[model samples]
Target: MEVTSPPPSLLLSDSDLEDCYDIIDPPLTTSNDGSTVSEDIHKSMDEFDRLINLDRARRKMALLNEETEKEEEKK
Candidate 1:
């Protein structure tokens, strides 16, 4: 698959980015209220985290591959 870097201006707004961060690193809650979090919410959050991790890893690998190819061409 071809991976292209996004333009800087295409990035999410600060507020939206913060929301994502909050979901990935939720605040510590001491309340054990039954209505705290539903099973579906937990599942969705987990799925989002997995997707984010996979995307990050793929980007990193693409960058490394680019660097490797450049080095090989220089050899």
Candidate 2:
């Protein structure tokens, strides 16, 4: 039987490895369209703020209703 060597595994050079970044790192902030990155960020932030405000509320008698954190609906 002829002896054959195993295929060489692909390995990066030391410099290449040093230049590589963590795989879990978020990708560069970018916009696929012509809009700028900052503009995209602002747009997303505005939408988030709107959604957050929807569930937000203030109690005038918070001092009286200090028993529970969530307000229950009167069924």
Candidate 3:
């Protein structure tokens, strides 16, 4: 059987590597169907913020309840 050589990237020079960036890391662009992409991203961000705030509030309430319990125990 014949031996095949390695791919072009393995043999690339520094300048060649720089020029190959388009192939390596292509540009990211949302499709132009509608405002759905931006709206979806915004919706996701809002949901994430809401969840984070909810968690923080729960933790604060728990701490407050613990303090109240300790104060009652001391009385």
Deviation from native of the Cα of residue 42 in model 1, angstroms: 0.6
Model 3 regions lying over 4 Å from their true place: 1-35
lDDT of 1 by residue, 29-60 (tens): 54565433455578789999999999999999
Expressed as tens digits, the lDDT of each residue in 4-36 for candidate 3 is 999976798887878798578754446575555
CA shift of 37, model 1, Å: 6.7
Q: List the residue pairs that clash in candidate 1.
A: none
For residues 1-75, could you state the per-residue lDDT of candidate 2 as single tens digits? 999776656667776665674344524557566675667888999999987776453343564466444444332
| lDDT comparison, 2 vs 3, better candidate | 3
**Each candidate: RMSD to true structure?**
19.6, 9.9, 6.8
Model 3's alpha-carbon lDDT is 0.83
Off by over 4 Å in 1: 1-37
Query: What total of clashing residue pairs does each candidate reach?
Result: 0, 0, 0
CA lDDT of each prediction against the hidden true structure: 0.84, 0.63, 0.83
TM-score of each: 0.51, 0.33, 0.54
TM-score winner between 1 and 3, please give it. 3
lDDT of 1 at 75: 100
Best-fitting candidate, scored by TM-score: 3
User: Which residue window of length 10 is worst by lDDT in model 1?
Assistant: 29-38
TM-score of 2: 0.33
